[model samples]
Target: MKIKAIAAAFAATVLTPFAMAEDQSDWALVIHGGAGVIERGQMTAEREAEYRAAMHAALDRGEAVLEAGGSALDAIEAVIHGMEDDPLFNAGRGAVFTAAGRNELDASIMDGATLNAGAVAGVTQVRHPISLARAVMERSRHVMLQGEGAETFAIEQGIEMVPPAWFFTERRWASMTRSLERLGLDLPERPEGAPELQGVDHGTLERDEREHRFGTVGVVALDSDGNIAAGTSTGGTTAKRWGRVGDSPILGAGTYASNASCGVSATGTGEYFIRLTVASRICALVEFQGLNLQDASDQVIQDELTAMGGDGGIVALTPSGEIAWSYNTPGMYRARQTAGGDPVVGIYGDED
Candidate 1:
């Protein structure tokens, strides 16, 4: 009887928590800052700790929302918003420099249960691009808005607007200047005064080059109610010209969500991602092809990115509470929290 009672008690203690956790719908959340050349040696212990703290803060914000029964969309937006406001990860306040030496922000959000999406691109005045994206998704009929029009819509919707200078940073400006100088040094000099073309001084003239150094910020969340959502934000590309926009504000490219499958947020080369539909493709592969979330993410980030001649990474969470992360670069800043309260966070690729 004593042995039987001990066995029963063990079962009760172990199984009860699992049963309750399963009953709660098994919530999970994941976030990423971007993927790039991150080496373990390059990141000092202090820097790594800072990155981890930021990631945890973002996760904690989202977890609170999920615990309080907030919709997955809300949780995702809140978490991403935190990153956007921080200057560390290069989304909103810390966006990269554009060709014109300015910052142009982009963001998107999606609700998996309803397929509702919102996006804003080339936004200069909005204080929080993600908030504008949510407004576009919920208040406006359009899926995306750009430039002054998007700003106008944001103003009408009561979104906080800031000056263009609000997006500037000294590091970004210095980086842009250095990049232009380097590009000039790499170009071959033409014959001395041969056909002095109007406005064509290849060596002296500085052409705007976009900064591809930083990664976008994103969140994927599964709430207690079994709903999933994803959100993404970016500063576009550093030193980009001709109003070039990246995958961040484009649905299915940088952000995607589906109630039947999962929610995904991507950070990498924007042009390649847009062509391959990286975010949506991951969800489709998992839902339709029966691939696990990790396998699907790997296929998309590795196979798909290679096929498209692009590289980057993604963070995802499925409705069944599985976490998926994949990156082809040397590193991607990411974090996760399981329904069981375990937390994992890292910046370098092998930091696990």
Candidate 2:
């Protein structure tokens, strides 16, 4: 009788931690806007409330999917697609204008189950770039397609395509004009004329140029099935020329996923990110070097990317229900929630 009691206690002890881990895995989702200087004083109460509401909506959508036993890929796509439709973010309908005054969107998606990936770049007519990215992964033979070719593929695949003007917004247009002015390019003046300022000089111009370097929105999720997935979308950089492409459309640079490891989404200077292979490097460090998710992300974003003079951040989630949110910039628009809990959202470093 004593032996039976001892065996039962041991079994309960061993199952406790597993039960805790299982609870943690039900639905973990995280999202981020581009990292930049987000000052609380500059944001109005109304604007802050809007951001909070948007993030909460995203968290709820993903949670619903997990609650229904959906895959991580489905949950990640649903959340990101919702953000793409939102004008407050720089993606899909709300993308910034290119140098040619047209919207050029890019997007990528990765499946941790098979490690398969898909991407689209320089697409102008696709209504939801994330949907096109998923189609590229599941329906098409190519991993990436660009420009008109991508639009053509999107149409053939029955994805929604919108008119070019549908993507234009007054705020994004204003941002593009400012970017062009900072780069010393001549642009048509606003109807109200430029505002007169005191003491604005070359230094201010240089700073403005640097401020426009970051752009993109992403999501990383761990579903109830213990699978991980990541998705990223962007309108590319403002005033970019020569059909320029950013890291958001690239697989290893902008996003990565592995069922045995983690999913990562990066936002920053795409050039430096691609050279560093930012997303894949994080997974490699964690899997090969035995580093935890947080340490691996910090070492890459702070030590590696910062060392290269690149400023940006990454959102990552491990299969074991761990979340790693790291960035070297002054702030990053980010939100996170585990399972059915309340979401934590922030725009600046100090808020963290």
Clash tally, candidates in order: 6, 0
Which structure among the candidates has the greatest lDDT? 2
Give me the runs in candidate 1 sitting further than 4 Å from their true place: 1-24, 185-212
- Give the per-residue lDDT of model 2 (tens digit) for 1-352: 0001111111334322112253344667788877765566655578668777887788888888877899888887888888888877788877888867888999999998899889999998888898899999999888999998989889899999887777876666767777887798876433232224234344433443343346588999887778889999999888788899989989889999997778999999889999999999999998899887778898999899999998789999888767777888877778877664456777767765
Candidate 2's C-alpha runs over 4 A off are 1-25, 186-213
Candidate that scores best on TM-score: 2
Model 1 worst lDDT window (10 residues): 1-10
RMSD (Cα, Å) of candidate 1?
9.1
Tell me how candidate 1 scores on lDDT.
0.78
In candidate 1, the residue pairs with backbone N, CA or C atoms under 3 Å apart (3 or more residues apart, or in different chains) clash, namely 97-239, 98-239, 99-239, 99-240, 210-238, 211-238
